[model samples]
Target: MRHFIAVSAIALAAGSAGAQEIAQADSDWYKAGQERIQAELAKTQNTNKARNVILFVADGNGVASNYMNRLYAGQMEGGMGDDYVQPQEAFPYLALVKTYNINAQTPDSAPTAGAMNTGVKQRFNLINLGENAIHGDCAKVSGNELTLFSELMTEAGKSVGAVTTARLTHATPAAVYAKTANRNWEDSVPEGCTAQADIATQMIDAMEAGTLDVALGGGARYFVPKGMGTPNGGTGHRPDDVNLIDRAKGLGIQFVHDKAGLDAAADNAPILGFWSDSHASYEADRPETEPSLADMTAKAIEALSTNENGFYLEIEAGRVDHANHATNAKRAMIDGKAFADAVALADEMTDDADTLIIVTADHEHAVAMNGYCGRGTPIDGLCFDVAKQGIEHSDELVLADDGKPFTVVGYLNGASSVMVKQDDGRFTAPDGRPEITQEQAQDLDYNQQVLIPKDSESHSGVDVALYAKGPWAHLFDGTIEQNVIFHVMNYATNAN
Candidate 1:
C-alpha cells in the first residue's frame, strides 16, 4: 500500500531558505506522513446506515485520464501540470473496478451502468437487463429484468434522481430506471413492439408515481414531437408526435428548459429540467444559458435533500466520454474540470459522517500519456525526451530514430486514421502516416495519432478506479467487481 504520496515534495527552498533547512522540513513531513498512515490504519470502521448517498461518474475516465486532468486542472489554477489533486482523489477510500461485460472483454455504458446501478453484470447494449436476456430480443426482457438500485431506494422511501450532462435518456442515467433489451430504445419503440415503453416514458412514469424526485439533463428532443427543435435546438425526435414535456407538465413535474426555469424550479415538487436538445455542449463550447454540471448537481441536492427519508442521487459528467470518443483532449480536460467541480461542491454540501459519496467511472478509454517529459511539462503540449539531452544542464530536444518529436498525449485508436485517395475514387494507405511537427501535434483541435485508426475511439478493457468517502466507504478498500458498487450503496443506506 502507498503510505502517502509525496505530492507536496517540491522545490521547498527555491529562493530564501537554505538547502539544509529544506532537508529538515522534508524529514519532518515524512514523519508526519508516517503518523498519518498509522492513524488511518487504526481508524475504526463506521457501520452506520447513511442518510444520503451520491454516485458521481466521470463516464469514461481512467487512471491516465485522471493524471492528465489533474495536470490540466493544476495549470488552470496557475500551477505546474503535475502534482494536482482532484476532489475525487481526496476521497479516503479507493478501489479498482473490473469493467468487462458478461460476454465481452470491453463493456459499453449500458451494461457497465447496469452493473454499478443494479448489482448485476449485464450484456453489452442491454439496459437494466440481467444476463439471461439476449442483446436485441425484447420478449426476453420480462423475466430477465433487474431492479435498479434507485428503484429499490425509492421503495424504501428515499427520494431518487439522476443528473447528467448527457441526455436524461442516455445510457448511464437511463439505467437507473429503464429496463430494455436494447439501450438505443430511448426515443423509438421498435416496430410492432407495443408492450415496451421507451426510456423517457419510464422517467415520466416513475415521476408520476412519486419515485423520481429530480430528473435533469439533455434530450428534450426525444420527449417532444418532431420539428420542435426551434424551442430548444432539438429535432423533436419522437415519431408518434407524443409531447412528453406536455405530459410531464400535466403530471405536475416542473418541466424546465433554460437556466431561468431551472432556478425557478419548485422545490416542493419534482424538477425535470431538460437543458439541451441532445447532449449538452462540452464545457469549453457551452452557452451561458445552459446550466453547468455543477449547477444541476447543487440544485438537485438542494431540492432532494429535503425529504425526511433521505435521497439517492446519480450525477454524471457524460460529455467527458463524448469528448474522449471524439479524441478531443482539450474538450475532455475542460469537462473533467466541470466534473471535479461538481464533486467538490457535493462534498461541501454534505457531511462525511452521515452521507456516503462514491465517485467512479463506468469504463475507460484508449488514451495514454506518451514520451518522456520534463518536470512541470504542459500536459496539453508536445512530449519532450528530457533524458536524452547531454549533461550540459540545458534542455534539448530528443528526436526519434526518424528524427521526429511525438506528442505527450495520444490514443490507442481514434480519428487519427490516415487515408490516401486511390485512383478509382476510393481511399487507401500503402505506407503509414508521416511524422508531424510539435506545433501540429499539440494543437487543441488536433486528433492525436493512434496505432489503429477508427471512426470513433474504442473503450479500454482495463479496470477503472473508484473513490469513496463517508459511511461504509471502507467497503471499497480492496479491488471489487463493478456490480459491488450497487451492493455497497444498498448496504450503506439499508435500502434493501
Candidate 2:
C-alpha cells in the first residue's frame, strides 16, 4: 500500500511526458547527444589486471526489465523515469550473452548459471556440474562436476563469497560451490539419491574446507534437522538430524541468522548466515531486520576485502525472477531497483581501476515492453494516446481492435492472462499471484496481460545484457556465450 501511494504520487508529480511539446530530431539539442557519443568513442580502455571481481546478477532481468526498472526508478526519484541512467549503464563495455542450456533453447536457472559460474554450458536442471550429468540422476554426476570460477579463485588463495536474495542453496548462488543433478534438491537428497549431496550439504562442505569465506543470504531451512526450526525461529527443512549451525561452529565459522548477528560478526572469522527460512523476502515486502541486497554485499565485501590476496564475490538479486514468474511488475521492478542500489554501493566500496564489477542476468523471462505510451508515461500504467500521430491534446485511452484499452507492459505467457471485468470497467486476475492489485493492467496486482495462460510465466531463450567496468572490461564489447563471463573473470583475476 505504501508503494502504491508513493509511486502514485510520483506519477502525479511528473505526470506524463506526453504533454511536453515535441522537439525535432535534428534540432540543436540533438547535437549534445551526438557529442556525447563522440566522447564515449574517444575514451581508452583500462587493460590493467584486476585484483578483485564483484559480479551482480539481477535474475530474469532482461533488456526490457532493466529499461523499465530504470524508468520506474527515475519516477520514484521525482523525474521522468526514462531520463534516469542506471549505474550499470555507465559501464564502459556492454554486450549480449546468449543464455541457452545444452538441451533447451530457453533454460531455467540451473544450467544458465552453470555457464556463468563454471565456464561451460550444461543441460537444464543441472547445477555447477557439467553436461555429462543427466538431470535427476545421481550416478551420472561423477566426473561431470564442473570447476567453479570461485573454486579457481579460491585455489589461487583469494577470498571468495556469495550473497543472494534467494536461498544461498538456490541454483544461482549454489552454482558457485554446489554440483548436483537436480536444482530442486536444496534441502534433501531424493529418496534414491541419498548417496549424493544436497546443495546445502555441498555449501557447508565447501565452507568447512575454507574455500568459501563469507556466505550470507537465506535458506536456513536446509541446514538444520527436519521438523525443527533454528534457535532464531527459522524452519528447518533438512532431512538429516544433524544441525549444520553447530557443525559450522565446530568448523570455526561464525553462523548468524539475523541482521544484528550479521552486523556483529567480525570480518576476521569465516561466516555462514541466513535470515529467512527460504529465499529472502521480496524487495517490495522485505522485513526491516532482514539484511538488504546492499547490506549483504557491503558486509561480504568488508570481510573479504581484508584478504591481502583480494577477493571474488557474487551478489544475486534472485527475487526478480520469482516476481516475474508470478507476473508481479511492481515487485520485479522494485527488486531490480534494489539490485541497482546494491551496484551503487559496490561502486562506492571499490574503485574501478583495480576491481572489476560486472552486472548481468543468467536468463530472461517471458516479459517485454510493449505499446507506445509516450515518453515519461508511468511504465506500469495503461496505454494512453495523448500525443501520438499528431494528436497534440487529447486525454484518450489507446484502444485495441476490440475497443478495450491495453497496457504498456505485457507478457508472453503467465497466470494473469485472463481478466475478469470489474465494476468500473477495469479488470483483475484471481489470487493476486504472488501479490495483488485491485485494478488490472497497470496496478501492482496487474499481470500485464499475457498471450498464453499457464501456472506461471516461463523463461525465454533470448540473450541478456552484460555490463562491466574496470580492468579488462573491454572484453565484454562483443556478443558472447554466457559461459564467456567465467573466462573473462578468470582472465581478469589472473586465476587462469
Candidate 3:
C-alpha cells in the first residue's frame, strides 16, 4: 500500500521553489505584477441593468479541473502551461461556490444545478423542486415546484434558450425549465408517475407555450416513440408512443438534426435541434456533421439577441463530467478546452457592458494532480523529474517507491484499478505497480492508475469557482452558497 506521507514528500520535493538567482528589481514578472494591480485599481464597477444573461456551466469542472485545463491549454500553445490564463480567468470578479446538496456532502448533478437555477437547495436527485418534495414521487411535485430563472426571464418577455454538448433534457440543461421530482424521468416516467409529463415533453411544452425560444443538443431518442427511428441511426426510447419531435413541428418550431441544418436555419424562426441520438460526440471525436459547442452557442446568441426585452441562455460543456467519470483525462481536458472556446465566442459576440456572462461549474470530481513535475510537463503524460537549474524539465522520469513511473493526472479511485482479472473472473492485485512508459501514458486512450477500485469515478466534496463579468459582477465578492448564483442573476436582470 502507498503511504500518504511518501506521496506528499514526492510532491514537495519536485515542486519546491528555489530562491531567486537574478535581480528582482527589473524582471518582467515583477513589473507585470505591479501593472496588474494598477489595472485592477483602474476598473470601475458597472451598475447598468443586464439586458442579456448567459450562464455557462462546465459540469464537474472544479478548481482542480480548471487548473489542469489551464496547464493543458498552455502546453498546447507552446508555453510553460502553469503561466497560461484561460478566458474565464480574465473575468473581473469571482467567488468560490459551495456545491453540496441538502442531503449529500458529495454532490451530484441534479441538485447542484437545481440550486443554481432556483434560489434554494433541495434533496439529491431532485430538480427545481422544494426541499419538502420527495424524490421519485410525482404527487409531491404539484405545489413544491420551484420557479426557474428561465421561467422568470420568459415571463418578463425575454427570449430563452438552452445549448449543451449533452441531451437537452439532461439535469444541467433541464434545470433551465423543466421541474420534476426525479432527474431520470427524461423520456419515460415510472409506473405511478405516468400522469406527469416527462422532461422531454416538458421542454416541448415550454417551447409551445412561448417560454423557450430555442433548444439545441443531442438525445433525439427521447423525442420519438420506440418504433420511430432518429436521424442518428437509433430508435426512440419514449414509452408513451408519442412523438414530441413531430409535436414541435406541428407547433411551427423549426427542427434540425445536423450542422448544415443549424447553419441554414432561418434567423427569425425558433429552432429545436439535436446533433446526435444520445449525447453529442466528445470534442476530440466529433464529426463534421455535428455542430461544436461554440457553433451551437453562436447560433443561440443569434436567435435570442433579437428580443428587445433581452434573453437568458444556458450553455453546458457536459461531456467533461462524463469523461472524468470514465477516468479519461485526455478527453476531459479536450472538452474543457472546447468549453473555454465557447465562452470566448460568447464573450466576443455580446457586449460585456449590458450582457451578464457567468462561467461556473455545478460540481467537482475526485481527480488529483500528483508528482509536482517540472514546468511545461505534458499534462496527460507520465510525470517527469524537475529541472535542477533550468526552466525546462529534465529527461529523467520520476519513479515511485515501487520503481514505476506514474501519471501527472490521476483519479483517487476509478475503473482502472491496480488489480487484474483472471480467466475465472476474480480480480487480483499484482505484487507491485505496473511499469508505465511515457508513450503509453501519453496515448489518447490511456487510463491513469487508480488506488481504489470503482466502477466509475465519484464526485468530490469540494468548492467550485465562479467567474463573472457585466452587470453586478462585483456582487460575487466572497465565498457563497451555490444558491446565490440564482439571486445574482435575478438581481442583474431585475426580474421578479
* Residue-by-residue lDDT tens digits, candidate 3, 148-224: 88889988889999999999999999998888888999997788774368999999999988888999999999998
Over the stretch 327-360, how does candidate 2's per-residue lDDT look in tens digits?
A: 8888899999999999999999998888999999
What lDDT would candidate 2 get against the real structure? 0.83
Report, for every candidate in turn, its global Cα lDDT versus the true structure: 0.83, 0.83, 0.90
RMSD of 2: 10.0
Name the runs in model 1 displaced over 4 angstroms: 1-39, 42-44, 387-395, 418-442
Tens-digit per-residue lDDT, 63-88, candidate 1? 77777889899988978767678999
**Cand. 2 TM to true fold:** 0.88
- Candidate 3 deviant stretches above 4 angstroms: 1-23, 421-428
Please provide the root mean square deviation of candidate 3 (C-alpha atoms, Å): 7.5
Candidate that would win on lDDT: 3
Q: Mind sharing the TM-score for model 3?
A: 0.94
Which window of ten consecutive residues has the lowest lDDT sum in model 2? 430-439
